[model samples]
Target: MATPKSAVYAASKHAVLGFSNALRMELAPIGIHLTTVNLGPVNTNFFDNADPSGKYRQSVRRYMLDPHKVAQKNCKKPL
Candidate 1:
């Protein structure tokens, strides 16, 4: 899912995902649980700065997830 102009951003996200997966296993023995939610572009003000031109935002508008709904889903999950 790496895009042409987001090499660093993509790498950092991958790094975090790997680290979280490893940490989740390490902590499971102690009854700690970890959850990682991989989401696509979220509908938020972030695009105002990140995509100031609005091109990217417009392109992915239909694919964007509502922030409130995402939050509600995660919050409802049992921990």
Candidate 2:
């Protein structure tokens, strides 16, 4: 159950994605490449102290992927 706070966090990540895309374009002429590993809901909090005791949170876990595995697999993509 991410509320208003998640908007800011999600926006920041989207901004980063745009920046990376532009950077890849700029460097492509020099043979540089980039890839964006867009992440979805994972088992972590946007804010460390965020409450995880709610039923919403509990249900979310049933579909949540492990952050470690996400990182490992995504890192192997061209970036």
Q: Pick the lDDT winner.
A: 1
Cα miss at 71, model 2 (Å)?
5.1
* Displacement of the residue 13 alpha carbon in candidate 1, Å: 0.7
lDDT of 2 by residue, 1-79 (tens): 3355377766888798889999999999999999887655677764245554455457566777787787777586643
Query: lDDT per prediction?
Result: 0.88, 0.70
In candidate 1 the C-alpha lDDT for residue 21 amounts to 97
* TM-score, every prediction: 0.70, 0.61
In candidate 1, list every pair of residues with a backbone clash: none
How do the residues 1-79 of candidate 1 rate in per-residue lDDT, one tens digit apiece?
Answer: 7875678888999999999999999999999999997899999998897768889889989999999887888786743
Query: Where does candidate 2 have its weakest 10-residue lDDT segment?
Result: 46-55
